[model samples]
Target: MTQKNTEDPSSQKNDSDCGCGGETGCRIEAVLSVDERGQMVLPKDVREKAGIRTGDKLALISWEKNGSICCLALMKADNLSCMVKDILGPLLNEQDRS
Candidate 1:
């Protein structure tokens, strides 16, 4: 028996079709499968292209809409920390005023 490609066509989008209308926007690089142990391996080429190396840490982020998970994203741990600070810095300031 053969398995059919179950990938969504929209997920095969390029940067232009990312709905962001930007040349440097995100793209659907590859589809991955999680094993029975709930582990997934990033393809070697994809990892190389993204500059991911051994012992690197990644932060998993999820987006929810209407109480359902809509998207999942991964970013470098250091970058994630910076982003959290950038977002929460202003919010923390507001709390100080209150």
Candidate 2:
């Protein structure tokens, strides 16, 4: 049996039959306060849903569009050069001797 999360009916918005809407697909607002140390804590449930964990790096992107600031979090891009060096380090060293 699956457990259902209870939501307030009063807060529910009428969904359009076309179903094209926000990225979350639901209209819910959550307000959070930032600390004095320039840190904002992500809610546990939101973090878990996004597959974020301790020691996992995240990139913060900020943009100014339409007179408002927008921020987003994304996974860090891998350094392909580092991986290539690790794989071809021995072969490159041998070539330098010739």
Candidate 3:
């Protein structure tokens, strides 16, 4: 289900490029479709750019706004683990000292 974005950037209809008429740092990279089995394939380009390889673990993170999920993100499991440890490790140590 991988497809290349052949559309030319210049020909893009949206004049909302940016206030400076330059590309924005954050923009849509690819659109993915989910199959009947609820399986979706991340575009090859996005996967490669993100350094995702076969069998790599990704944690699907979601953000809730006003009780509704507003955004979704993916992070490497190992990095997520490191972040959790960095944030909670100190708190746990403080509790142990208490």
Candidate 4:
């Protein structure tokens, strides 16, 4: 399944790609099933389009709402560091002044 983003954040896919585009600007890209071993394979076309290659690592992230896990997102392993910095950079800088 392919989805188009009728909004910003093109290709960056920075954990917030949302990929769901339509009247609501959000939709499911694919439905994956986990095996008994708890492993799911991403389709080849999606992987190729995302530049994900063999041996590439991914991070599974989840969002909590009302104290329950409500959403999930997958991110390239390498991008996690940059995301951490982007989130913590300001807080770290602020701490330096203390």
Q: What is the lDDT of residue 10 in candidate 2?
A: 46
Instruction: Please report the TM-score between candidate 4 and the true structure.
Output: 0.61
- Per-residue lDDT of model 1, residues 1-95, tens digit only: 99999998756866333234335476777899999999999899988987889998999987665676666778889888998899999999999
Q: What's the C-alpha lDDT at position 30 in model 3?
A: 85
Rank all candidate structures by their TM-score, best first, as comma-separated numbers: 3, 4, 1, 2
lDDT of each: 0.79, 0.61, 0.80, 0.78
TM-score between candidate 1 and the true structure: 0.61
Backbone clash total, candidate 1: 0
| Tens digit of per-residue lDDT, candidate 3, span 1-98 | 99999999776766333232335355567888989999989999999999999999999987665676666778899889999999999999999999
TM-score of 3: 0.65
- Estimate candidate 4's alpha-carbon lDDT, on a 0 to 1 scale: 0.78
**CA RMSD of all predictions:** 10.9, 13.4, 12.4, 11.0
lDDT of 4 at 6: 68
Better of 1 and 3 by lDDT: 3
Off by over 4 Å in 3: 1-26
Deviating ranges (above 4 Å) for candidate 2: 1-29, 66-98
What TM-score, over all chains together, does every model reach? 0.61, 0.41, 0.65, 0.61
After superposing candidate 4 on the true structure, give the runs of residues whose Cα lies further than 4 Å from its correct spot.
1-25
lDDT of 4 by residue, 2-52 (tens): 988767654455554333435555467689999999999889888987789
What lDDT, from 0 to 1, does candidate 1 have?
0.79
Candidate 2 Cα deviation (angstroms), residue 1 = 62
